[model samples]
Target chain A: MDNLKIERTKSTPYIFFDAASGRLRVEGESYPENVVKFYTPVLDWLHGYFAEGADNITLEFKVAYFNSSTSKVFMTIFDLLEEYVTTGRMIEVVWICDRDNDVSIECGEEFKEEVEQLSFRIEAC
Target chain B: MNIRSLYLEEEAVLKRAEGLLMSQQCFSLDVYRELYEEYRKLLKQMKTLVNVADLTQAELKTLSEELGKVSRIDGLTELYNRRYFREIFLHTWQQAVEEKDILSLLMIDIDYFKKYNDTYGHLQGDECLKAVAAEFQRAVGHPEDFVARFGGEEFVILLPHSDAEAAIDVAKRLLQNIENLCMEHSASPFGQRVTISVGIACRCPTSDVKPNTLLDEADQALYKAKAAGRNCFKLYV
Candidate 1:
């Protein structure tokens, strides 16, 4: 699988997925006007990576503000990672936010609570 | 998966469960139990996704409304800012033209504002501006009257459905209110205290008249007021 990199815009976040290192990073605010249109390629890329029988992957999210649609998309992402972990694959998810951002912290905590197999951590920077 | 595909996949899972139920007699108990368990897990995940989307959407909507209100108001004096004034004033003017009703405008300027700022500093100047703005709000009691901070050391008031006589009365009341504030302005030449100059313009707006003409007329009157004296009102012909 090849690495994927999508630049951030005023409305959408930056996405960087490294196939060699198994490191994925999403940064910036995510409030795209068309959430599905913006996220379809990213989801397709993830599907390709997982189908290649990837052994270990680490995903980090440093999002500032995300609308409700993006929140649902994140849920979908978490479900995919959890599916891989159940199949004996090593998958790690990290949520990074500012210490003073109560909303972001709460969101990360809620995601951590819902996941069963994915190793998740919330880090304040 | 994307939102559309995610929902489609959920529907497909449900159809698979339905298909298994239709061929129930053909399947062994262990196989049927495993299929049912998988169906239940998929349903649970779908439920979680919908719930999170709904909750976050409601939160973002409220935040967006609050930001809309904040954008319309001036940060310092809590009065309507120039941008909002420009929008609403145009709307009000259009309404006046349609109804053939009189519209009055007031352009107000603080006398010796630069001197006052030099003596008391910017912090106190801001306080003085806030105090004057508060007095304007109090002096204009009519529901039809609109007040806004035009810019630094300048303010504007719109009096709808009011003629020149009524507008003049409002101007007199405003002058008295500011004089009563008695916020000492040692730097001013007018009575050794803060004072304002007022310019009034009234028109029964017509569709043919440009909207900015009223503003220009009031500004001219304000110039005349400043020329006559530091603390007085002038009416445009």
Candidate 2:
């Protein structure tokens, strides 16, 4: 499968998906002017990559802050990951948060609880 | 693996996916690839559209709060308007109680301002308002100090951690600043220059005492300053 790389913008996160290495990363803030317009193509690439399944994969999320709109989009992404885990895919999802931002830490924990199927870890970096 | 290997292998994956080559998989790789491409576009678009509608509902909650703030500023003085003044006054009063901080309120009025407006015309009255507002804004150097245009010819200054002494000092300096500007007011009462009257009230505010308690005291003191012949300040007893 092809790799996907999206550059960071002021209101959106940096996204990188590598099918060969089985690694996915989203880093930076996420509160796009139009969340749908910004995340559509990237999620499309992710769906395609997930279909071409690998045995083991990990997605790293290091988001400083995200609006509620962006969180819903993230819930979709995590739910997709959770589906793969339920189907016996080895998926380890890591959410890295800054120490000062307790809200980010709490959000990661909430996602972990919500997506019970995926192996989720909230690490304060 | 290290990031370099991951990146290099990604380039290799792109090479294969680019060639339109079919890999060994569960079923017809060509058919699966075509189906995945077709399904990916629709699936993502559908998911995102559903979420977008849900997001706007939540986004509107925060949007209204921001709009409230933007609308709370006075157009002429570029200072907070009366509504936000009351909001912040309550907020600061609450903070003072929580942190055991001193809070002070200053009610300022331009002496014989109606006469100044009548003598100099409304345009110059507007110019005077802007200049005075700017000067007061400049004088309050602390980031937390709150200032608002209370109404015509009146402004409020809130100093959240200051005592009566500090408030008096600020009032004195503001008087000196206006005196130095020497804006002409040939109407009547005071001298040839425009002057101001200030009233101050300070306390470690608590719920036992309302935000209005200090405002009323400051207003009373302002009245006293006006009665004591207009160009000075009085502290609430």
Residue lDDT tens for model 1, A43-108: 889889989988789899999888766876887888888988999999999999999876677778
Query: Where is model 2 chain A poorest over a 10-residue stretch in terms of lDDT?
Result: A107-116
Interface RMSD in Å per candidate, to 1 decimal?
A: 3.3, 11.0
Off by over 4 Å in 1: A1-12, A15-24, A30-58, A66-73, A87-90, A99-102, B1-8, B14-39, B118-123
Number of the predicted model whose TM-score against the real structure is largest: 1
What iRMS does model 1 reach?
3.3
Candidate 1 clashes between residue pairs 3 or more apart in a chain or in different chains = none
Model 2 over residues B74-140: C-alpha lDDT tens digits? 9999999999999889888998989989989999999889999999999999999998888788768
Q: What does the lDDT read for residue B35 in candidate 2?
A: 56
What candidate 2 gets wrong by more than 4 Å, as runs, is A1-125, B1-30, B43-69
